[model samples]
Target: MARIKVRARAVDMLGRQQIAGIPTAVHELFKNAHDAYADNVRVDYFRADELFILRDDGIGMTLEDFEGRWLTLGTESKVGANDPGKRVWTGPRKATVRAITGEKGIGRLAIAAIGPQVLALTRSIRPEGLGSLVVSLIQWGLFEVPGLDLEAIEVPVVELQGDALPDLEVVTGLADRIRANISHLGDQIPADMRQRLLSELDMADFDPEAIYSQIDGPKLAGDNFGTHFFIRPTNPVLADDIEQSDDAGSEATPLEKMLLGFGNTMMPQSGEPPISAQFWDHREDGISRDLIGGAAFFTPAEFDSADHHIEGEFDEFGQFTGSVSVYGQPARQHTIVWPDSSGRPTECGPFRLRFAYLQGLLKDSRVPPDEWARLSGKLNKIGGLYVYRDNIRILPYGNSDFDFVGIERRRTKSAQDWFFSYRRIFGAVELTHARNSNLVEKAGREGFRANRAYREMTSMLENFFERLAIDFFRPTSQFGSEFNSMKAEINQEAKLLAKRATKTKERQGEFKTELDTFFTSIEKGHPTREAERIRAMTEERLSAVATIKSPEAAADALLNAEADARRAVAALEKSITVIKC
Candidate 1:
């Protein structure tokens, strides 16, 4: 009997090809740290050296655990046979247990997306005492070699004495093994490619002294048990992932945007422990900043400028119980029945939705013009309903290009009736790993898979938006019935004013002509100087009343005013008709 075997290239398929990009790769690592109960994770990039390092003070893995779990593909340690009771605990402290964010064992392979080579170091804490530091160097390029079997690769794992980390000699030895593999594949590959591979494996030039100096630093000294990954010659694509800022005209990298919805940045949840993340630039003239400490995109002014605020949770029965607050109006509690055609309990678990809606141009916003411009720019950049699971943001949801909730599609269908746009919403749909197990994300981190649960969830969300439109947006909109009434009033007033102006012009012309005749007759009679002076005075007094140069000009002015008024009335009527239809 023949048995199936996975080629060495399968690792590449599960890693670099599977993950979305650099940001998502970093996100996966962050999730891993979170599952390990890390309170903080610091990612540092050395621009000059093209090196990336991520350090976390989590409960690190022992040698046996690393071999059994980290090295094993598709391990079920986190899944625990799909039983929630047996799922991995986030921390050793049973008092505060967080649902594990990482279930697929291949998440660790995401490191391959970052770079070709990675040096992983970890020290575990045991019930007896501190475990020996375990270190492994993985050359992902080896996995990509054609015709190579998965078992053909040899990854050396070294356990250092006490709490000691691996030294340069140890790293050099591991790198030598990578060089040996490349040398073995020399005849099968091009000379130039082989030379390039050999050049990249120049571990003699690699110096991690700066990185080791941080081992006993403030962040890792106290715990002395955590995980550290040092990756060299990071993927060049990362350098291009720059976020152009509209406000300050500055630039931010993917690392800066990583912690946007982490911890209490968006909305704080009770009993959830705060996780701090930072990005350090170790290059000369580089600036190190706290990733999660930046101000939120939606400020108080932004929230206040919103036309409507909707926040609530869906129960297991698919009933939404929440409050809708139209700006300047008292909050009203409302319950919306889910439009479930299945007539059964939803497979999509209950999730919370919080969103602030803003109308285009912010015509009713009280914020100052300059401030509003800045806020509008932010909305255009970061707007869209974001989905968060356990306070961690799911990618492609809040992105300006990603229309995960079909908002843009709905708007395109009935543009006039669909008052909502993806650009006008600052929202979040919160879910938990345990409850939203069925709503699985795609392997590429693009979005949720189009499963029944996902369909139900999106259907519910769309229904809620429809209800919001009917209950709040349509009634308070400036393009509603009240607007039509105001336009009608203005049109009537304009028509009356135009008629009165025309009549007044005629009367003035008549008076001017009579005065001109009287003045001319007096001048022809050759009256005394006093009579001439009196006539001139009367003419001057009457001259002020003659506004229109001619009857035709006066008629043209009235015609234009009437035409404008008529056009305005027609537009208003058409709009009203559409709304009614």
Candidate 2:
């Protein structure tokens, strides 16, 4: 029997309603551990490799918790609650206990997602006398008996097996200790599977002196707080095979580089927290810095049945971002905040669309419903196949990490895919409804409101990233430098852009005037002024102007056509004059 050690029975997934892999089921457990005050957590795999364990030193389980709550499936996590988003795990008198982040009982299913069977063993470490509580695996597996109804509707679950897996008590060895304590298990992870657990426990402890000695000759004290996820796995049945970094010569991991770049960026104040960055560009000129926020899942997919929202005011720094997801289509699925036996969530809405696309829009002008509908129409057809759409035409953006958006394959893998899965996924479309809505009378009708909204969002995102970058890169300075005026540079560029926009508007107006004259000037013009060929006329005029990138040039082409029409009229006038003579 392959023996792997893991903290088990931390919670029961059967108690909650889910049918999936262990990772999906245990999402809640890890969430609680992270949210809890606990700094460390351990996930252990035992004898069968499938026997899972999750242990956290935050706080142990209590009698009421074990019997009534922890074992209860689908508990009401937030009711009349402040921050109904989460639960509060405060030790009596706040005696330095770990904070907990779990809310939904469904998190127990995350374990099921990770593997087939789990042996739960949890205890609370709080005020002196909150005696350790013991709950059995069988008890958890049977927490929800068949045919029980929740307040919402009939519980869809058909059967709840309390004794879902074999029960065993294991003690001793590297795997066992790690199964017990969450902290030590982190470093012990190996790059690829096939190694024994106890064989590498010693490698987990910090090698501070060795690490510090290599940092620019000697390490600075401040950067000591960081977590490292080593890429190594030994023992196939007991461990997982993971991709390893062969760059032993480098002192830092690639993930660390991505993070450090954010910290040392200019205008760092803007890159903190919800503001953490995705990328930074600090040109060696040491004068300019630009940082972009974390890459949010920009889901452009929408369906006719899909109803999603984009709402959030830009913070003080002017960064606006979020998602647009759609699930009403035949293919897409909705995310379930609360699990149901059907494995599909009815409450969490069917579709979402996220984008910084709105960032540019936020700065543009308020977008009208018509324009949004137009974009949604073109975009919804993309499904999992495409990402970017420009000017109502589907644009093939690069593929997403999760392979969800496939350019070549175009297949929807599953409801839960790692490449596209987000712990917190939200998309925003700037609900820009028309500002200066009446300006359409002067500017022309078809695109005024829509154009303004587009310009606004585009402008906001550009400056937003610029500001964030400046803040992030502010810390790293030359030995001597003088205060520079970046805003002045920005102002100058803005003026040029405005001038160009005005010219674009003028050219569009003139293009309409020229096109009408062009067809009239043709001797072969339809003898009748019929309305039937309006569409064809438009096609011909547009085709003529297609090669012209400059709006001004297009307008000139139309004007030339008008000039010909006048000449035709003049020739007829000249003929009558000669006849009278």
Candidate 3:
């Protein structure tokens, strides 16, 4: 019998290289928490220990679940939730939220991408309260053993009461003895190293008696069960030490970068619970940062605007159903910004789009002209069309780089018609699982796949923006006072461009007529092939100019064909003068 073997490095490749980044890997874990029906998920970065502790107040997995489902790759537990025919819900969470954010089972392997050592402790909630907590220590290195099949590797699992800490007694005892002995050998060690060693003492911070006394520690959280993922990073480095250099060789890890970028945004502020505390609600604050000071509301009707809205309702399984509101003043014209013959037929359904014209405009543009640089920085840091699935965000979707809906791409193609790009427009398309089941996420957790449903979703969104730009964002007499200065500036710029084009056209026309006349006179006098070819070419150039449909096309013709016509006229005049002499 032939044996097929896979190396452990493959797991690492699948986890790290396959996913976008560490931040995305963490986001996948967050999705897993969401799928697990966790109302509150806490992500803690232990700066000292070089560890990430992601705990959630959700229905945790049982021993069987840990081994059979979690350990097993490509499990179908989450896939069941994708089916609209059946509703997937956990114990008490059923009353609140029934949808799952995860489907592909490979998300669990994201832990391997982030770290090699995973100490996953979870407790399933019983009807009474806390249940038996299961601890699974996964050393990813074991999978990398030579000549070993992935299936052969077994991660050990230990079950304990909700209050029981993993290796608490032994670790605490050792920590205390080590702490006591540290003072004796302190003179031999450097002061900084000694302090570092003292700070690095593990399991000594927690009070053993206090932890043991509680029948249900923070481990069993929320209304039901909870899960804790204690991961020691493979590339462990002190957070502070990472900032010592700015070179590529000394750059921070993805997790470190994410922490530096969004830590302040996601971290709980004043009067909030600590990382160890349970069920801290950061949704409001989080939304504010996530949206970059943009509004987080459902309908534009709430704003009491007379703006127009496009509503879509689909009865098909997993179709989009929601209203897209154009926030700016609706104009009479509805222009299509699509490239010629490249526009796709788009149907609307399954999602909500809100074109927030001035949502973050005030916040971003409030600064003085001199402070425009600061404002630009802020906008770059915190602007984009956000995609919210249900209420939560999908990682890297509406980020600075992930212009998934191709707003900038469209803007580049149709700059005149595009009101604002992904950077300037504070817009969002919200979707619910019940309504948007067909919009499935890619297994690699990048973003939604470009399926027919997603393509339709994107088309509908593009149309919404198009409507806003052509119909609403356009200058109007109704809001003349508001747009008067902008209109004046635009008019002045346009007139200058038009004047330049007119001068160029007159020059080209004069030259073209002269060139054509010269060629025609030559042909009539002594018909030559060169004269016919020159006349033909000149006529072709004139035809090109006449056929110019848009301002862009006209400018292009003036720049190229008009310049060539002038040169031809100059050369023809010189030849005629020479012949006369």
Candidate 4:
């Protein structure tokens, strides 16, 4: 029988295919750290030295574990075979409580994907006053040899003895270099820490330098066991791939630097405003410039509870549980135009949506105009619909480029009615490892396969957003209808006033003609009292006609003029009021 063999070229191909980009490869390392149950993971990119370091205080692996499990592909540590062909839970707790994220045992390959060479230095205590450490060097360039079998390649591993090991001295210098590279971590590094390294540093008893003198100094002190992965990419350009702002003149806050560097979803042109303690809630105040138009927006309180917090759970087919909190002023009305199979117009999702009015505004913000735009950019990068399995974000699921629920595509189809955009939402879906095992991720770390459970979950979310759109736009639609009705009524009354003014002018015109005829008849005659009185009444009537034509003139003006004309006629009946012709 012939045995199947994997070529060295296949390993290189898998690395390229699995790790999408530099950012994705970095995210994979974060998952590995989380799986190791590390409370804090430190990632440092030393551009000056073209080095990338990821250090975590997790349970470091021994030489046996490294060769047997870590090096083996498709290791079954996370899940085990139930009988023969099927796999079941293996209780993924090594030395700590954590939901294991590294199931396929290929997370280590991500380091190779980022660079050609990698150094993994891991240390773990075995017994009282005894510990073990190993330094493994993986040079990927050797694997590139054509037609080389993967089984033939061997990574160089060196085991270190107690304090005497020379590797300890090199590690000490490397630790110092890492510390020197970073000026200050600010809130990221605890301020009260005695030693420079927050968790690893112990200056209480041993001299800070003594830790470097012996392997037991800081490296082996108090469960500080971990792996420090150092990789220096062959390409010099890869070192500076992660750009930094070069404005030496202006001091940038930690938050600003993060937004500028990682805000992938930010609009290209809307320049982020300068970070200040004052303009935190600028979104509300800015949009409120037009009060009437802005009133179209609303808060979750209008539709749900006053708390503005929403929570739900699902254990039907797969276990899903999460909560959402909404904040900010409110957003403009977004209508749902997408027609559902049920013949009803769909909105956003079957999952509850708690929209932050100003894109990603949270509750804690009050006076200081929160950088709403920056916050939006940050949310856009993280994803509006965040999906987390075992509290770890699944790749390509909630990422900016990945539209898991087809929100972007639907929005593009008809943006007017289907106005839901990933940028405008800050949402999260939490799934446990045991309950959501059915949401299996692809080997490439792209995302969960489109299985039945995954499809149902996405469909439910889509329906939720759709329903929200319908409910949200209902009141605004009614308000618009009422406004149009009132406008029509006002217009009708204005038209009636114009018609009455027109009729008054016509009567005045007829009276003017009669007066002119009377005057013409008396042109060649002598004085006549009755004729003079008629002329006087006609002049008074003409004055009323002018007032009638001037619609804006007081309504009383027409009435007063008519009364005077009648009196003049009565006077003519009695005797003469003006000289007759």
Report each candidate's C-alpha RMSD, comma-separated, in the order given.
14.5, 26.5, 22.2, 19.8
Instruction: Give the CA lDDT, 0 to 100, for residue 241 in model 1.
Output: 57
Against the unseen true structure, what C-alpha lDDT does each candidate score? 0.70, 0.31, 0.53, 0.49
Among these predictions, the greatest lDDT belongs to 1
The model with the greatest TM-score is: 1
Global Cα lDDT for candidate 1: 0.70
In candidate 4, what residue range of length 10 has the lowest lDDT sum?
273-282
Q: What's the C-alpha lDDT at position 301 in model 4?
A: 26
Task: Judge candidate 1 at residue 348 and give its lDDT.
Answer: 81
Q: Tens digits of per-residue lDDT for model 1 on 1-581? A: 99999988898898888987887888888778877778878788777778888988788899998999998898777774335566444444432466676687646899998888788888876566567778888888777777778877777788887645566888888788777866766675457756766666774346455467753321333348888888887887766554344555333345444445554354433344446666565544665544444554454446666666778998775779998766535677888888784566678888998887765653444344577677677777667788888777777677666777788888898865666888878878889877788988888777789999999888888887776666555646432444334435545766676799898888888767766665675666633454445546545534532466787876676666556556655653443331110
Query: lDDT tens string, model 4, 324-440?
Result: 333322323333322223443222123322323232223222212345444444444433555655445566554455577777888788764554576555445656565566677
lDDT score of residue 401 within candidate 3: 54
lDDT minimum window of 10 residues, candidate 3: 266-275
> Can you give the TM-score per candidate against the true fold?
0.75, 0.29, 0.58, 0.55
Give the per-residue lDDT digits (tens) of candidate 3, residues 41-148. Answer: 666554444555677777788888888888776677666665656744466645454456676665677776666556677888645555677876665544433444
Q: Cα miss at 386, model 1 (Å)?
A: 1.2
TM-score of 4: 0.55
Of models 2 and 4, which has the larger lDDT? 4
